[model samples]
Target: MLRMEILKLIRNNVVALIIAYILAMSIGINILSFGFDELAWVERWLPILTIFYVVILIDLLFWMAAMQISEDMETNMIQVMRTSRNVIQYFFSKHVLLLLFILVAAFLGIIPMADQFGFVLNFLYVTLVFSVVMIASGVLLAMIVKKQSVVMLAGSVVTGFIFAVMVRLVFPLWNISPIPFNPFEAFIKAYYYLYLPVEPPNQSYVALTLIAVLFYIISLYVFKKLTFDRGFRL
Candidate 1:
């Protein structure tokens, strides 16, 4: 089921968009490097590519998945799939596939800048986990809200709030200096302390991951009781 969703998504324009965006970001970084110096370019551009812009791009994929799911319900496809064993697992698998797509796109986008920026495997792991959680949360929001527009609005608003409040405001205060191999420090502190050398992974990555996971789990429960009208009734 997951494989099917992934293959279908690859046929869409989203993949092309990701590739084009990555190319553009890389080119922009190089062009800026000649004018501003390598360190400045990393500070100004890398975070935009790796964190901010990446979030918006991945949100597009999330929206696509929501629309696809809604379409399936409208066409009775979901009802048909529901008859199968482990239907919820199949639904969740689609979210997993979308998350993987986001992560791969992000990594590939960052690859072009690695020579100047350096790469951290831990950053990739945290980013991957964060992407997965966002994808799941988006799906869950769509299922709960039922109305497409409302789902999107709710997801965006809630996600924005969490990013601004929880990830940005809260995590920085935590003390993880004493614990070596601290996963929290590995992810968030890297974003804060190691800003340029490797384009420090966003300090909010770990917090975002946790929030997304919690929302995803909550969405699953809501989806279990959801019923689709199949007539654009929303």
Candidate 2:
């Protein structure tokens, strides 16, 4: 079942385009920064990863989660699929496919920085947590709001924009603690700040990951209860 889900993503034209874009950006980012003698080797990758996760993958994963499930519901394919597999199995297979995409794009973007074990480890941790959090966020939202996939895709882009603003423009400028809203910030901050020589900012992110897990649990329940019934009503 998981294999089938993965193959579906692999064949998706958008997914192919995205992977090609990742490859282009991976090389392009380096090319654009070609002559920076002052730039540290490790410093170069952060931007690539930043653009990949912050600008692209977050919304992509979210939209995929929502759209794929929404399509399944709309066509009553989900009902058919559910006959052989429980709701949990169905949703998770889709979720894991997107998660795998995230890891692929992330590793591709950060390949140059691979020698730095510390940075690589932190980035992978954040990337995994981030994939789940963003997918859950979209799936959770989609389960409640019935709409076309295009509508949801647009919403995901807007969300990615807002998240970028919050993490890049707003959060960094302020010194205020975002205890209640830390997960959003921590997803970027956890690894972005790891290269700093100070005490690791690992604590908040660990807590944030737990919160993300909670969000995912809620998303699963919502998928089962909300989406599972919609096919019959249709």
Candidate 3:
């Protein structure tokens, strides 16, 4: 079932196009930067990782969920599957596929710079947590909005807004202050607090992890409840 789900994504033209675009952009940037200064590759890795984390990762998960679930619901394929398989199996399959996609993309994006970064465990942990949060949010949004187009638009806007706010908080100017009680800001802060030189309160780590888990649990419950019926409204 997981194999089939992955194949379905492979056959999607939009997915293929997006993947190609990412690869081309990554390669092009690496080539252009390498020509200017061979020793400055390490400096390039941070921006690449940041772009992948803030935009590519979220966009990929959102579109994949929208395509896999929304399209299946639209065609009534989910209804057929539900007759034979439990909702948990279906949901788990989707989650597994999503994780696989994220892992593959992250591997591709990070491996080139891994030597320079020197295998940071904090980076890996933060990436895993961020992937879970984004995947859960994508699945939840896909369940709520059955239309792929709307999901794509809504996800882009929401992810962009969150990314912008978080980026501001991370690289704040002298006079700027991040919004108080911003969960996204806290999440990014916790990430940097763990890996970077900054020393945030220890509670930041606990709070971020708890928030990620909470979102995952909520997504799971919503998915199960919705799939219990006709498998999300079309």
Name the 10 consecutive residues with the lowest summed lDDT in model 1. Answer: 176-185
Please provide, for model 3 over 31-67, each residue's C-alpha lDDT reduced to its tens digit, 9 standing for 90 to 100: 5545543557546355444444534564566567656
Worst window of 10 by summed lDDT in candidate 2: 46-55
> Please, what are the lDDT tens digits per residue for candidate 1 over residues 129-200?
655555665566566666555655665654454345334423347642334332223333343343445444
Candidates 1 and 3, the one with greater lDDT: 3
Task: Tell me the lDDT of model 3 at 224.
Answer: 71
lDDT string, candidate 2, 108-215, tens digits: 666656888888777777778877887887776666555544645456544755365455533456664444443465565665565454746655766878888998
Against the true structure, candidate 3 has what lDDT?
Answer: 0.63
Q: Tell me the spans in candidate 2 whose CA falls farther than 4 Å from its real position.
A: 30-55, 76-79, 82-84, 153-183, 197-203, 229-234
TM-score of 2: 0.77
- Kindly report which residue stretches of model 3 are placed more than 4 angstroms away from their true locations once superposed: 28-45, 48-55, 78-80, 116-118, 169-171, 174-182, 190-195, 198-206, 230-234
Q: Cα lDDT for residue 90, model 2?
A: 69
Cand. 1 TM to true fold: 0.62
TM-score per candidate, chains pooled = 0.62, 0.77, 0.77
Determine the backbone clash count of candidate 1: 0
Off by over 4 Å in 1: 11-19, 30-44, 76-84, 112-119, 145-211, 227-234
